[model samples]
Target chain A: MKAGSPIATSSIWPEAPAAPPSGLARSQHKSPGETVAGRSAVTERAGRARTTKRGQPDREPGLKRANFGRGAGLPTLLLLPQVLILVFFFFIPSLRALTQSVLLSDPFGTTVHFVWFDNFKALFASGEYRQSLVTTAWFTVAQNVITLAIAVVLAFATDRVVRARSVYRTLILLPYAIAPAIAGILWAFLFNPVVGPLAHMLHGLGISWDPNRNPNDALWLVIMAASWKHICYDYIFLVVGLLAVPVSLMEAAAVDGAGPVRRFFLIALPMLGPTIFFLAVMNFIYGFFETFAIIDAVTHGGPAGATNILVYKVFVDGFINLDLGSSAAQSVLLMSFALICTLLQFRYFDHKVNYGV
Target chain B: MVERAPILDMICHAILIAGAMLVCVPLYFAFVAGSLTIAEVQKVPLPWLPGDQFLANLQTAWVKADFSRSFLNSIVVALGITAGKIVVSLLSAFAITYFRFRYRMLAFWLIFMSLMLPIEVRIVPTFEAVANAALPLQWLADLLHVADLWKWISGHDVAIALEWNMVNTYPGLILPLIASATATFLFRQFFLTVPDELCEAARLDGASPLRFFWSILLPLSVSNIVALSIILFLFGWNQYLWPLLFTTDKDMATAVIALKNLIPRSDSEPAWNIAMSGALLAMLPPTLVILLLQRWFLKGLVDSSK
Candidate 1:
């Protein structure tokens, strides 16, 4: 009934140009005679606005905005099952990990002592943990830089194509679906010294490349493997980013005597700032967490612990060695790092990304 | 596309094709190794071309190693997780979108917080939860003193071991992985984009909420649902760590987990071809899914990230 009425009409017209009711008007805006449904619906849309409460129009600086529902009981009931599951499986376990981080537990988990912050102190003091940190830092840097560079180059190439672009995209992205474990195995097989083709090529080139015995070789191999799967993801995003760049802007730049290379560096690169930032954080997180399977399947964290990333070490300490305290501590640290990245990504990037040209 | 440069276009295709080849090198080796004889694979610099023993290797992996069973196990586990996540998130997304409940943001934040606590970070407690499924129930019983009431009624002492061990079970494999915040978030975003008028129209038609959900919301979100399914299927099918931790029994192992086990542990005379065959088997399902649902899978990835 309220669908086309003046007040209800403005709620649905996402592109309605009327300025949101400011200060005095917000108080007077809710019509006393508005039907219950219309009032609630209007309030829901108003509630989504940045500056105000239920009955006021949102002044958010965007063309698209989500309309939230405003009812009671049934909606709450509908959400309960998922909330229960998440609370049970996710929140409780994470809270347990947080509490466990503060307490020191024995191998069998029978006896526990509340030793607050000692586990964290021990982690900071440990040489192995420190080395893992260094390794993780370097790994994150190398993997993301290489992955982004390759992806940007390839995405630029793919974006330039006027024919069969999807074919190239499909082929490149096939690796994205392959599990990291499988990717690890495949890459490890390629570098397998005995019958591996890449190993044979290295041998033919007189480099004496043996990943099993060489720490640096093992590290680079794992990095390449991890980066291999990720290039597809970054490439897809970059292609999307490149496609989103306005042709008029580039054409205008071209007419201004900018070369193709200059056009890319000056115009396209800056325009893709948000995409690049998003991919950086994602690639870094991927290196930190998701590379565990890759490292496990490929190097098993070593030719002398060379490839043991922080995530792999966490798994080793927790599941393999049963060091609950240290593992829990490591997990807490990992969680903090992830949370920071996620928060930073949202705080600085989301608004910019949404306000796309 | 803005410029017409023939030479640059040739260079671009050349570079892309080369990169594609590099990406496929490992896969090609795996395929070749899967097809070759063990003796041939053992030869220095294994043959790059496919051999005629493909059927033999597949037969060996399937019949002798019981990979077919593991493959079926993976399918069941993947499908189970996908369906459970979809159902759970669908209900929550529906409720959160349509209802104005107290502490609604609290419920939303609680689900959102789970995105940070990935399974890897809380593997230990999660393991304990699954292993001692009755632990929480026991705590509840203790809190509520149900044991006292039971003893008073029965007039005999009873032990509530309630050893609800889920190790090596289908539900165990699926349940822990199903409470995904990402899926819920994606669904909520999609549902939010849906015009509120649809709901109002349904309400005016005297349609019950369930009827509206079944006939209207579900039908409207088919594309989103399909895309999410494709992505979730790959995720479930490709799980390695959880399956490895839980499924100690070879018969209960997922194809990916069992494939890792198939690698010859012995230092002397490894069966490289068999291992390749196992890898090939492990990759087949998800690879086929991605290839077939490439469009939906890509769309889902972009949408979820957004």
Candidate 2:
């Protein structure tokens, strides 16, 4: 379904006399002939007149305006707890990180000195930091591509099967419930060089598989684990998106002599563009941030830091090495990444109504 | 059928079955490893079948990792976060939707800004804030010179520092993590769909805002609440990085973090059976929640993402 799609008023409030002729509700009841630009001026007076005549005849017309609760005092009081939390936890810490990015402080915080741009400059100067930027880019792209490709295939396949659709869905979605750390652990166990069956099989096939010493193997291990956990999430959204595709379109395509594969590639896949884009943005964020637990569990950014994505480096620098300035700088960079992703998502969501069938 | 493509259908089933199997293999392997003895687990080919040492391995892992304490801590933290988020989000959402207040949109936007600052992005500063929970208040007091005023009035210097460190505590674990923009937005969306007539009728009956909310809105939101709670509980339980960094005390560790402790530090071969058993145990609660409340879980997932 499209974002901000109107909910059916009758289904939610069965006892209500009729739909409340308010702003949002009025917009939901437009006729086919009415233009969206002309809706507000036409519906506003009509809705007020209709509602006043049909219900609440005793109430003053001045009070007929929307929003039943009056004044700001009680509402302000109700909002205090959550606002305080946002201030203390989210706003304060984010601001603190921003300020800390410009200052160098001792581990114990007993001494501090302002070093504006030095942390960022040093980060950009270091080959390891530059390598980490490249590493994070590669990791995010590889994991996202692999996960999305598999999820799209599985979701479309599940839609084609009529016998036990939900059974396959539930089975595939089981991984979403597992913690990323546990997923990493399970995969690590399966690929452990000494005792792992999969590793043994790979060795039997003459592939040298050693995650402990091989940087490429270590990166691949984390990538596989992260993708394994992420596929379920993408599959759920893709399945919903696929289900929303019209069967009539498929039938019409079939009537035109299109094969099932051709019909899917031409019709269903195009209809899923918005959903795929949404999933891509989500997967970008997941790969950037949420896969820290997987990397920590599976590779710990090991084998000479080959798997040290940016988020893991932030943790290692801040916690392990106690380089607060550098880590805060990295946090600032990651915050910008989050902001960019969020902006992209909101922009896409704003245009989704136009994209819908 | 439009085309009755049995061959296509068979191919689809084959793809689905293979995908499902691929998704489930790691978990099945974990189970198999957990059921084996240490030596059997270390075998080159590894026993594909279950051995008789499952309970023994589970007990060893449980005792070694101190899961009894960690699981209790996880339960408390997860429940605290779930309840805290629901209460906070419900109140804020109700206020935003029902009341026409000045700066109401401003407040909503301010909370919305938190979507950009996830725990991962602000790890160090959040940790510092939690370590000294009163830091913000202390800063305010310092800026306003409260301590100086008190010292001048009493002719004695008074240390006005407030130490309410939340590290390794339940509030530390739950409160910082409870300001959820998604949950707030979900409740807001649901609240918007509610007919305005209901609120008008409640107001006409002389019911106050809180009374209307408690008596009318809350009951209607049961399904939404349950769905959101299922999602929030799973989110809280599956938390790893936050708990790993915040809770240094072994007694305060979560079950997910405790799974890390089962990994061997020495050069000696790690105990695969025990670690796998711990991993299985660590994932059980959320897994059961997903399986038992699959409908609500999916509903919450889809709704919150929206």
Candidate 3:
């Protein structure tokens, strides 16, 4: 189900005690003399009052309250402990972090920094910082393209020949199960100089290697590593998109003398565009912050800090260097970058995408 | 009639198989490295073959790295996080979708926006909170009015009863991610697809909200639950950054932090064998989860809605 047609209003909250389900339905239908809108308002309030009574039957009053919680109520209570935990630990801490970035540390617990642009300036002034931002942007764009392309090829290919389609799916998705740190470490060793098996293999093939020393190598390797590690993530999304396309539509296009390429470009691809676009946004974000694993493990920002992405840089500055202020500044920028892109996508492209049911 | 181009298909299959091999190489390397003797592994050219040292290396990794403890620690942390996340996210999704209470949209948006708030950004305050957090052990001690309370509960069930002392426990790793914005988003989107009549029919049948959800909505949404569970479990099991940053207790939590710890120390003090072992150990749960959950994941896309 994509989106439901609303049958009942959310007049009740997180966990209103449930009233009789029948009472709720009856409440929806007006009696012969009752106006429909007026009936709903009265019944909704009555349902609310009944659910609030909790224990023991206020029969008619309690009945109304029960109706309110039945739809949206239960999930709210189940979600409460977690929502509260998140509000404090996740949401509040993030707020505190956000606040710290803006304010100067004071005896009275962080007075205004007042230099609105200073922290941002410090971030921009550092060549390492600017390099990481640009590097991360390039990484996101490149990685998403390669990952999506490779995923499309693999999913389409499997949709044709594979008898054990699910097995291929599982193998491709194996990387998603591995930790980023583990992947980075594993790949780092694979890309090692003079000794790594891959190095030996590449050398035997007369290909120049060394991801750590060359900046281009570092950037490309990070892209490849991200796509390599995340091919399955995109594959899952694309295949879901693929399954959404009706076989009849493709068969009809085939009967009309369309080639596989023509059918794909004209019908399947357009149909899959929404999933693809959603994935582009997903991949873009992953490339922005989530690539630190491969970056850290493979190159540790590299021989010349070439592989340094923003999140890892934040990690180094905050934890390794213990420069909390600059780190907070960098954090704010990273958050803003992500927030802006997500908001822009939602605002502009959201309505354009047709996620198949 | 099909025009089967043998050469092109062969080339494509070759590349696909090669890609598969390429993906497995690191794990192969790790296995090779982990099974070799230290001296063999550190030799001028590393051994490419599986050696006879698997047992010896495993024993050493277990004894020296406390890998068994780390494995147990990971299990607890992963399970705790997954369970907490499932309960919290389900309820939250349920509430946001069905409830018409005050601030429903606001709560939903707050949960929605949270998907983009990187934990790396929140590290400073999270660390501060962790460091100064009231020790559940100390609080219990205060409750008991005993000075040696930490020591008293160090090895018992009572130790787990303390709240703030979760520093090294599974709760520390699980609590922060108990409520996930991503899961909420997914679940809310899924709930939007359900037919309203079923909910209404159940309501008219006298199903309490909880009763209705447990019976009617939840059973229908099992595929969504399964899909969310697999994703959530993998995320929990593979979690590295938060666990590494937040908890100091190496003895009890997911093994990823411990695996990260085992990264070769220096030129003179390498620990690659144990590190690789730990990495492999950390990988098992997620791999197992994926293998088991694929059917459910695929089912969701296939059944969908009428």
Candidate 4:
């Protein structure tokens, strides 16, 4: 595989190099056949790949096999079940959801109506559908803002405050390490007006409370639960982002006579923008899909449906209602909402993030 | 340079302290409230102290779950899934990072997609496929001659209760639990940091490829493996939806689902106190793991996340 000028075997005939193609003519100065598996395959095929359909010896092995073997191949092997499971379970089901959403199911028989946009129409028409979408959007934005703000503050605080920053960081992440459902459930006990300790404490101090029945109260509690779980993600990003910001830059900012808020806004915040952006992206992703666990636990999107999220709606529709098509329709619609947020992120904040990084 | 302002610093500390209090408040409530009786829990101005009814609540939780068995099942499923994931993800990360073969990108993309896409998208198809697989390790009991072996090991037989669910069988609970793209992703990233020159030199010095990995690569990734173990364990242990789907009755893997069920399907007020207790119970393994492995977990997160 080593690339070099062709050599004459006649010039040095004492002993052959191990596994060398050792019997070459004196000065024909022939180029190597370029058909060898390792060397020429990559070099020649590096440019215009010729179509040698199958069994091409010149074709190199996969990225792993050419470099490592069974022991090294373990990750790929482990990933196989993950891949197979994902493909068979996840991808196929999504594809099925797409298909099922189309064919309207009637009492007599299910038929592939190819209704085209009817499912979507039904989604738009349903009052619950629109309400859920708005609620989900509200949750996503509120959760992201609150989580990111807290995370940034905490991250900066921990970075600069306590001597035991790492310990604090772990403790900060403690809420995250617990299951979302469990956290939600725990918060439920804490925030429940009747039974919750916080409410009890408030009541003991003679403050009547009922988050479950009040719309804003219920919304805030659910958002709080969702946001609390992600505080670690935000904190970690900011911490890492803070770490990546060089001490030299901060010293220079300090040397320039800027207050903490001014320096942060003008200099450090700009540098941390990418981290913030990354966190925002991560927050949207989490808010869209993963919030269901916490939502299930805390409110079950309850009181008067103050916190019913889209994914939870999908769960309700598909699992609870046994209406497959509507859920699939909702899932697609949910994706659009996600897409819009993503686009807004890209269009506006992306520039700042890109520049900062 | 800006002068250090003591007030601003104190304010910052105050805010952080407030945040910390906010974070710890629920955990404080969970244990404190877990001790209250049902009537006491619902009573106006909820009990201020750990009531004598803590044991009663725990008993309610324990029996409601058949929880000793549930706990045993969660452990078995968690352990089974963790082992399966570690072994599988080790192989996966290995295959992905080093193995050169056909459709490697295809494989890589599949894993990446799994990470990107939500699990809800896949649960249905996974259910259909797993349901059709017709796998049975029940005879594993007969093979081992002890349907009671797990019972002996875990000191309880919860699977017997959920046996009719068929998912109580090992393959249903454990086999589907093996897949993890995050581990593969992290491992591959970790592997990339190892010096390729060491590998080349080892191969040149007459070591086989497998030997090169065992001697050179894996030993170096001890920290990474430990980190993956924690993540996979938590993911497996806290798994709510997947196990919920498979275990129709109560076969193992049921605490998370049981907690969901505990929310009072009847419209009578759900038992918040006992539910919190059960949740605290479920959070044990992962929390214990975090407390034990925080050092490595932080290092791993910083290393890979960076």
**Candidate 2: misplaced stretches above 4 Å?**
A1-3, A6-65, A352-357
Error of 3 at A25 (Å): 35
For candidate 1, what is the recovered fraction of reference interface contacts?
0.52
Give the per-prediction TM-score of chain B: 0.94, 0.97, 0.81, 0.79
Instruction: Order the candidate numbers by TM-score, best to worst.
Output: 2, 1, 3, 4
Off by over 4 Å in 3: A2-79, A106-113, A203-216, A344-349, A353-357, B1-12, B43-48, B130-166, B192-198, B269-274, B297-306
Fnat for every candidate? 0.52, 0.65, 0.38, 0.42
Better of 3 and 4 by TM-score: 3
Candidate 3 lDDT, B15-94, residue by residue in tens: 56655675687888888878877667666467768888777777776666676887777777777776777677777767
How would you encode candidate 4's per-residue C-alpha lDDT over B155-265 as one tens digit per residue? 875553213333446667777657666566556554543555777788789886568767877788776677666666776678776676777767455567676666643
TM-score of each: 0.88, 0.90, 0.78, 0.77
Instruction: Report the lDDT tens digits of candidate 4 across residue range A235-346.
Output: 7556654543445566777788766667666866776665576568778888888777787767777877778888788777766776667767776666565556545443
DockQ of each: 0.43, 0.55, 0.25, 0.23
Q: Which segments of model 4 are wrong by more than 4 Å?
A: A1-80, A106-113, A164-167, A200-211, A333-357, B1-4, B47-49, B52-56, B134-170, B174-177, B261-272, B302-306
Q: Rank all candidate structures by their DockQ, best first, as comma-separated numbers.
A: 2, 1, 3, 4
TM-score of chain B of 1: 0.94
Best by TM-score: 2
Residues A61-107 of candidate 2 have per-residue lDDT tens digits of 21223465468888888899899999998999999999999999999
Chain A TM-scores, per candidate, are 0.81, 0.82, 0.74, 0.72
RMSD of each predicted structure: 8.0, 6.7, 11.1, 14.1
